[model samples]
Target: MFKKPVNDWKTSSPLRSSDRKKLRLKIASSYSIDTAEADVLVPEGILSVKFKSYLNEPGVAYLAPDGDRDPLWFSLGKGSDAQREDALLIPTIYTLWKMPKLLPSLSTPKAVIPIISGGADLMIPGVIHCPPSLNEGQLVSICKYERVDIDGAPTPMLSVPLAVGRMAVGSDQLQDSSQEKGKAVLVLHTWKDHLWELGSKKDVPPSEPIKTEDGAEENEDNTNSKAEEEVEDKSNSEMPANLEPVLPEVKTPTYTPDEVSQLLHMSLVQAITQSLSSLPASAFPIPATIFYTNHILPNRPHFPELVLHPSSPHEPPTADSPSTDSPSPDPSSITIKTSSHKSLTAFLKHAEKSGLISTKAPQKHSTQTDMLVTAVNAAHRDVETHHSFATIGEIEAKAARKAAREEDEKKQRAAANLEIDVQELWKPHLDSVELFEAMGESISKQYTAQEVRSLLNSYFATHQLVNPHDQAYIALDQALTACVIPKPKSKKKSPAEEAPLDQAKVEFMKRDELLKKVLNSMQNWYQVKNGDMGDEVALKKGKLAPIQVVMKMRQGRKASTLITGFEPFNIVAEDLSEDLRKLCAGATSIAPIPGKPANSGMEVLVQGKQSKSVVNYLVGKGVPEKWIEVQDATKGKKK
Candidate 1:
């Protein structure tokens, strides 16, 4: 009853080119349902061929480190139009393979991919189009081919289609080129091991079979099938709430303090490997272990193995720690032992020579202050440098004038030169320039010429006798001294004060008078369609202004208590209740809130006594009693 299935299907691996050609023939035969002619795998007509410049190509991919789990190269693609901007284009199958415990579908817009350069990790946006037939644990092959005109050699001109597939077992290579047939010249050169295993019936990992040879059909199935697969995977792939992503583990380096500090400054993981090459055998090799465990591990919350040590170097020394001892008989200085010392005796000897573990007794605070004063006096020096306090020619002219005056007085003294050093005078100018630069342009604009001169003068004066540290404090003090506070002055009063207006003195427009008369005259009023006025309008007959209608309507209701559920204009004649109809019929004038459905004739009153039942009802409905205002018009008071 068992019949052999057709062996006409192509099963060539990408690594083999000769087998690929043979496989192509088989693919062509098996693809067609029609059995009339030799159905060979043939290429559809090549569309426009695009050549991507090596430096300008959108996608730039590199290889990952060897030890990384599921080592994959990362590729970044630039936007087609935006210059120098790159983004990740994550393949559906490759993303799912990289994260096998989860399912990926069209809905997943983002993915994490391995970046080969420096073993970096990249977060990329997912592609909307799902891949066909490829499943988890597969390598993604990116293939493009192009023809080359090498040394006037003419190669075979054959039509070939460009194609790429996810690998089930090993790494896949990617090639980029600029040609149609050349693009398909992806010469794969390996045998399909799966076909050989089919006959033996051994255990094989679950894999989705390739659907068809026609790429178009495969593309169509990719969308719907991925959705279904994702739904199916949801239940099976569920992990604990605390489960997190794991980062690849790396080796630690043996680092000395200088080396460790240098590596910390560099932020290079390879620095650990380099550091280990120079470390002495006695010191533990643990820079990568400590640095990564302390800083890197925390950054990767999903990677728990990164947590290695809990204690910092500043913690208490251990049992075998070196002894704490005094240094040699140096009268003036003290020294301490360095952590790098080999042994206790060695550390003590070095500390003694360096005056760290000193033999001299500690000085009292008053004695220390006296020693500092002596040091300051010894450091002072008197040296005069020439300055352009006045220009060279000006100094010469002033000297000549002084000489003539002194000769006229009949007293000839030695001629004193007033020439100042240009460099010394310009020091203040240079300092001013630095100050102006530091304050930035906006602040510099607010300074007046006098203030600028004062600042410059203070800057130069401090430098003449003091060091930079003391000069800063002097400059600050000078600025504070220069600041002036203005005193407040009393305001002058006018001779006459305007009096507040009384009711009779208040001015009224014609419309205002009409409004008062209209309200006093109205017996009943209600909203009606303007279209139904029929020339005998109520407002016209009463000689009432629109403003009066609005004012009286406001008087009939608390401004905030208008009917809210429906628009006033939408309330037709049929909506009027019997009580409202009677109220309107009894009065010749009425006023109702313009936006409410209530009838209006005389004043309507709302009263509240705060009964326990009423309070409970308001509370049940989540209403605040403070928001409800009750007014008793009869009593002329608000409650």
Candidate 2:
């Protein structure tokens, strides 16, 4: 369930002393540990974070103890009802690492680690060892297989727990031997998941061989020996007598250009036949880049490798062995450069000649290098006759990607609709002291431009400065002239260029011009309020600084994007980080801006160079386009 990052996360105050004691007692009772031990494990002053796991199930809380950024425990069904008794507390990988023996453990082969991490349950057939004392619904940890040197001989031992969950069936069912096809444990959390990513993101610690009672070790060795014998027997029964024994060393087969071209052709046919329906009509005339990224690459087939057999020289080589070291490559990431075509454009051109797809010509003024794919000929003979190479996992992955894209679009639309109120106000300068006094108001107060205009008009009416001939023009009096017009600079002038003092006539200005002059003479400021209930934040002196998105290359050549200057917009850093994690499908964190006060806002750091996505998200949140600055330091860096 935690395979994806937790959503809607917000930190609350630290738990109270009374509540902390109750929580400790509950933990001790659930894990069958002493109260003192539980107290030592979970100390006081731990922080609580609230989040929503599922959209329908709205109450989930994460507990992060002191000195740790990653949460150690999480509780489900923890809602507003304080007296609710059904809440379930589960330990995270961080907690399990500190106390490896907290729960009974089951051993699984290393081959299934990735599958289990991808959110699959622990199947019975994959389990190599299980404790006989485990009961249904009891909490259990799943450990990986480790080879240990026991008395100079390699012996397999169960490593520390990498995942934690509940037993799916009792030990009686597991020991029956016939029950070899059901689920052994319902996996809830695993290593490298979002929960682990929330922490320091450290690799799994080195395993220490679990110590057992005197005779227990011998019994475990006997069980493993029997299991190995059974596997050997099954393999020997399946092998033909004429075949040579398999070798330990394995090699990835190299493909010739012609074979790669054939694979590319097959992949194109498969995409046109099976994946074209998933694209909407609105997406027609798709660019070559989009077609390659979203369609062709995902449907590409893996090139099978050949196993060597010296005795069967005339016969075809067998398929590659399904060993842990050489796992099947993901077909979604296959590149066209390996094929003879060398690029997507060339491959699509080849397909066009084969009557599989049609391309739209670029316009005369267009800058694009490649033409768009306008249509796919699904009714063509090759498309209809070709066998599909897409697997169930690939199809499901495509659907998931489509769904995630749609959800992100929905969030962007919602953010764009959010209302932001920005008000521009003017504060009176010291030079306007006499003017404010004449208008019967305090010079220390700030006023909106419209309010200042109204005051000026009222003062003009009282002083009768409006021109009798034309109301659009205002006759400037002594105070208005002193405040709006600047003093003349002293300069030597020739007699012919100088104007006589008595010849200076009365200065007259348009009311609109006078208003502009009045506003320019005062201090400019603005306040921003997001939505109706959001607090209004004001900048008293100058314009608000733009939100900055900077991407810097880290030590391993990975890019990390940092965002700052969100305080003026009244955005919470923690909330924004959570949203970005979901949008980018990567880990995110918030830290206090360096050299800034603790009470000041924080800066959000994400794991990748997602400057474009961050900019769009800010704009959708009502930040104007001109108020954002993006800098990418990785632009010219070589991978």
Model 2 weakest 10-residue run by lDDT = 239-248
Query: Candidate 1, which segments miss by more than 4 Å at Cα?
Result: 1-137, 141-165, 168-505, 508-639
Predictions in order: lDDT: 0.25, 0.70
- Compute each candidate's TM-score over C-alphas: 0.14, 0.36
lDDT of 2 by residue, 1-639 (tens): 678777787766677888777778888888876554576556767666777764444554545664446667776653632224666778888888767768777776555666788777877655666766678998888888655788998666666789988899987677665664668789888998877788765457677554443354555665555444443343211211121111112222345555667765766777777768566777688888777656765555643323111122133434443323232332322356556777678888888998888897788888976689998888889887886664433866776798578767876766655746667788878556678887889787778889999999999999999999999999988878777876545557665555663256447889999999888888778777766554646555645577888898889688899999987777788889999999989999988888988866688999998988898888778887777888877775322
In model 2, which regions exceed 4 Å deviation? 54-56, 78-83, 149-152, 212-639
Q: Estimate the lDDT of model 2.
A: 0.70
lDDT, candidate 1, 1-639, per-residue tens: 001222323221122344333323442333221111111111121011112323344332211211211111122334421112233222222222322322212111111111111111111111122234434334333211112234784221111111122233111111111111111111111011221122322222233221222343334344433433433333322211221111111112223433322222222222222332244545432332233323222222121112111123322322345111111111100111112442333433433353322222225753322111000011112101111121222343576697568554542221111111011011112223334443232322333334444554544464442235543322222222212111123235332321221222322223233223322322322322223334442221211111111111234552211111122222222232223334333212223545545653222211222223323332232233442333433345544
* RMSD values, in order shown: 35.8, 24.8
Best candidate according to lDDT: 2
